[model samples]
Target: MTKGEQTRRFIIKQSAELFNQHGYAGSSLSDITLATGIKKGGLYRHFASKDEIAVEAFNYACQIVGGKIEEAVQKGETSYDKLMAYFRVYEHAAESPPFIGGCPLLNTAVESDDSHPLLRSKAQESSGRTLDGIREIVEQGRASGEFRADVNAEALAMLTLSLLEGGIMLSRLEGSNRPMQLNIESYSSYLKQFCLK
Candidate 1:
C-alpha cells in the first residue's frame, strides 16, 4: 500500500484502541489527534469527521475481538473443545487490555443506541457476526455427533451471545470476576450436558 494509505490505517488502528477505551462521545477529534500524534488536518485527510473515525474505530475493535476468538477456536482439541474454547474466549477477552472498556460491541451499543443510528447498526452487526460464529460451531458439533442431535443452533447462538455479553457487563460493573467465573462455570456444565459423552 502507499504511504498515505498506510498512514491512514495506522491512524485508524491507534484511534480504535483509544475509542475502545473511551466511548465515541468521549473521544474528541483532539483526543484522536493527540493519541495518534496526527494533526486534525491529517486526520481529516483520512477520515471525514470524528464520527467517521469512530465508526472505523469500532470496526477495528470488533476485528481485534473476532481475531482473538478465531485464534481460540483454532487452538482447541476437538469440536467440543473448540466450542468450549469459543466460550472461554470471552473470559480471556474480558481480561485483555483491548477489552479495558469491556466489550466494544456492548459499549457502543449502549452509548450509541439513542444518538447514532449508524453506530448502533455497526454494533448490532458486530454482535450478529459473533452469533453467526456461535451458530456455526453448534452446527459443527451436531454434525460431528459431539452435540445432541436436537440442539437448536440458533437458540444456542442467542443464548451464548446473551450469556457472554451479560457476563462481561456484570463482571465489569461489579469490579469482580465472580459473575463471569460463575457464568462460565455454568457454561461448562451446559456444554457437558449437551456436547459431552
Candidate 2:
C-alpha cells in the first residue's frame, strides 16, 4: 500500500479505540489528533471531517471484532459448536474485550441512537448482518438434522444476539465477568433444546 494509505489506516486504527471508548460527540477533534498523533492539518488531509473519520473508525473497529469472531466460529465443526464458539469470544469481555472499549455495536448503538443518524444507521446495518449470520447457522443446523426441524431460526438468532450483547453490557458496567459468564452458561444449556433427539 502507498504511504498515504498506510497513514490513513494508522489513523483509523488509533482513532477506533478512541471512538469506541468515547462516543462520537464525546470524542473531540483534539482527542482524535492526540490518539493518532496527527495534527489538525494532517488529519484534514486524510479525512474530510470528523464525521468521515468516525465512520471509518467505527467500521475498522467492527472489522477487527468480526474477524476475531469469524476466526473462532470457523474452528467448530458443528453449528452448535460454532454458535458456542461465537459466544466464547466474548466470555471474558469485561477483562479482555475483543476491542479496548467493549463491543462497538453495543456502544455505537446506545450512543448514536438519538444523536448520530449516520452512526445509528451503520450500527443497524452491522446488527442486521450479525443477525443474518446467526440465522444462517441455525438454518444450516436444521438442514443437517442437528437442530430440530421446528426450530425458529430467526427468533433464536435474535435471542442469542440479545443475550450476548446484554451480557456484555452488564458485565462491562459492573466491571466483572459474572454477568457474561452466567448468560453464556444459561444459553448453552438452553440451546440444547434445539438439538435433535
Regions more than 4 Å wrong, model 1: 92-100, 195-197
- Badly placed stretches (over 4 Å) of model 2 are 194-196
Query: Which whole-number lDDT from 0 to 100 does residue 41 have in model 2?
Result: 98
Lowest summed lDDT across 10 adjacent residues in model 1 is found at 92-101
Per-residue lDDT of candidate 2, residues 1-197 (tens digit): 99999999999999889989887888999998888888999999999999999899999999999999999999999999898877799999899999999999999999999999999999999999999999999999999989998889999999999999999999999999999999998888888855543
lDDT of candidate 2 at residue 67, scale 0 to 100? 96
- TM-score of each model, paired residue for residue: 0.91, 0.98
Tens-digit lDDT string for candidate 1 (1-197) = 99998998899888887877788888888998888899999988988888888888888888887887789889986766776665576664445533456688888999899999999999989888888888998898888887889888899888888888888888777777777778888878887887565
Clashing pairs in 1: none
